[model samples]
Target: MFKVGDHVVYPYHGAGTIQDIEEKDILGEKLNYFVVFFPLNHVTLMLPENRVKTSGLRKIIQPKQIDELATALKPTESSTSKKDAARPYSKENETLLKSGDIMDAAMVISNLTSKEGERTNGLHMEDRKNLDRAKQFIVSELMLVNDLSEEEAYQFITDNSKGA
Candidate 1:
């Protein structure tokens, strides 16, 4: 279980801090929930304590792991072709985002970035959205963990890695 003020990744929502744990009566039953604040979107999320395990809540990557992520982003080949590289390609990037696995997240960044074409010009609509979401996940985590600004984290990724 995460304590208040702990940094955590909330799957598709990206990184957030546990602000508080509140116990309240809901539906006539008392349950505890974690109040998490997502800095990126300026939003708060309340998650049931009992559902934390299955909810994809995870601790942020360690500082050393940043280098590991960079290594993972150093890609060779994952997608089949540039034309069909969105949606079902690279597992939709949905599975990886849901896993909350840092390495998988890195692969999302790598795979999407490695796609041929500039930006969303040649990709399917869903694929473009997936790439944006994947970048958000990486950038959000980098902001808190590395004490870097949003632009810096993004630039870090662009400089150290390829593609997106």
Candidate 2:
């Protein structure tokens, strides 16, 4: 369980700080919830305490882990495109996002990036959405953990991956 001031990432919601935990009576039952604040939007989210594990709430990755993830992003080609062929591609992408591994997320983005005139309408839409999700996840974690601004984190990633 996370305490107040802990940084966590909520899948698809970006990174947030746990502000407090409160217990309230609901339907004659006492339930606990964590109040988290999203730094990106100044929005607050109340997540049930018991659901943290199942909901994919996890502490930010350490610096070493981030470095590994950055390295993974530098490789663009996939050995087997069929890894995602058994299931629907969109569903596979959703599962990847939920994994909360920035490297896996970045792989999805890198694999889908298209060259000029190579993207179809459907593939282009999916690529854009997945890329945005990957960027948000990486940027938010980097900004919080490294004490860098979002813009700086973004630029760092872009610069590091420019040769990939």
- How displaced is residue 66 in candidate 1, in Å? 0.7
How far in Å is the alpha carbon of 10 misplaced in model 1? 0.9
Over the stretch 51-131, how does candidate 2's per-residue lDDT look in tens digits?
898988889878777677667666354444333322235656667887876666777655554221133333545556777
Candidate 2, pairs of clashing residues:
none
- Estimate the Cα RMSD of every predicted model relative to the unseen true structure: 2.8, 3.6
Query: RMSD to the native, candidate 2?
Result: 3.6
Task: Give me the candidate number with maximum TM-score.
Answer: 1
TM-score of 2: 0.82
Error of 1 at 134 (Å): 0.6
Q: What is the lDDT, from 0 to 100, of the residue 140 in candidate 1?
A: 90
Model 2 CA lDDT for position 112: 51
TM-score of each: 0.86, 0.82
Clashing pairs in 1: 113-163, 113-164
TM-score of 1: 0.86
